[model samples]
Target: MFTLFKRSIVLILLGLLWENASRFSSINPAFCPPFTEVLQAWWELAVSGDLWVEFSASIRRSLAGFSLALLIGIPLGLLIGWYPLVRDLLNPTFEVFRNTARLALLPVFILFLGIGEISKITIVFYACIIPILLNTIAAVKSVDLLLIKSARSMNVSSFKLFLKVIFPASIPSIFTGIRMAGTGCILVLIAAEMVGAREGLGFLITYSQFNFQIAEMYAGILTISALGLIVNQGLILLEQRFSRWKQLPK
Candidate 1:
């Protein structure tokens, strides 16, 4: 409780500093509104349920894309990592594809999928897949060979050996991948939505900018930042729960 209070106080101070800087500076208020103004705009939008509707749409798109990426990437990565032949056959292609920036394909996605949820979700999925696939592959490959050998010597079945030994060893890496993918999902979703979204934080930001609602634009940006922070913290909590045996140093 004390820690939370201290953090809140620090944040409040920082906000005050920012508000003063923006208010006094010759900088255009249209570009950077005072913190108090942004907060007031945020409060108004929240009360109207407008912010909630946008937030919900953004969250739904991000999660759907993220989930699909995980489902496809993890199994394929595990297979490629575990089997040399599979790795040899797929690694070059996978590396090439991963190197191809998802944003670069935005035009293609828009052309093919249209400026709708399909295009936005496709971009998010593409952005999310790389981290998940790479992490899963690395995790499987990094499993201690000695542990596998010991399990084999003990007459442990192949399936059981993977379930009991490899999976446990790879969990940390898996969590790292998940966290990375989650961030990627948020980024891609926002960018995609900004292009042509009817409802989302991105849309709100764009619309506010066009209408010269500078404070509302800043408020939308703040809301997106808050959402990203919440997602990251949730992932951290999940990682801690799953990897409790690997405790951090005090």
Candidate 2:
């Protein structure tokens, strides 16, 4: 409760400073509109339902890319981690692609897939996959040798040993990767939308800025920040729930 109170107080102070800067500082209002004006612009968009439409478009694309990453990354990570031959065969390829920036391929994607939804989704998927795959591999590799030996002593089959021991032990690390990938998905999708999309919060902000609608631009920025925060908090809750067996740091 005390922490929450301190945070609230700090936020309020920041808002006051922002309002004063817009109202009284040397900064031009055209570039830095008052916070209340930004709130008003947000309210207008919300009432017209335009906010929801654009927000949903971005959300759908992000989720699609994230889901693809999860489906492909987890199994591939596990396979590479569990089998030495598979690791030797694929790790080099994975390293090459992972080291390359996903955004640098945006133009290539556009050339092949066009500036359509496919290109955008591809960029997001590429951005999200690296963190998830690497994290899963690390998690699997970090499983205790003693645990594996104990499971082997119990006469467990190879498949059963993996399912009963390795997979469970790696859940916490997998969730960490998932959380990082989720953030990557959002960020990459937003950048993709800003470049080529006609709709989405990113487009909305770019359009507003180009039109010199400072309040609306700030509102879009605020919306994106708030949305990211909410999503991350939700992921934290899920991580806590799924990794309940792990000893969490205080």
User: For model 2, how does the per-residue alpha-carbon lDDT over 182-213 read when each residue is reduced to its tens digit?
Assistant: 88888888888888889988898888888998
Stretches of model 1 off by over 4 angstroms after superposition: 8-10, 247-250
Question: Which prediction has the highest TM-score against the true structure?
Answer: 2
Q: Score residue 75 of candidate 1 by CA lDDT.
A: 82
Error of 2 at 111 (Å): 1.3
Taking the tens digit of each residue's C-alpha lDDT, what string does model 1 give over 177-242? Answer: 989999888887888888888999889999998999988888899998898889889999998898
Q: Estimate each model's TM-score.
A: 0.94, 0.94
- Screening candidate 2 with a backbone cut-off below 3 angstroms (N, C-alpha, C), the clashing residue pairs are none
Model 1 misses residue 221 by how many Å? 0.6
What number of clashing residue pairs does each candidate have, in the order they appear? Answer: 0, 0
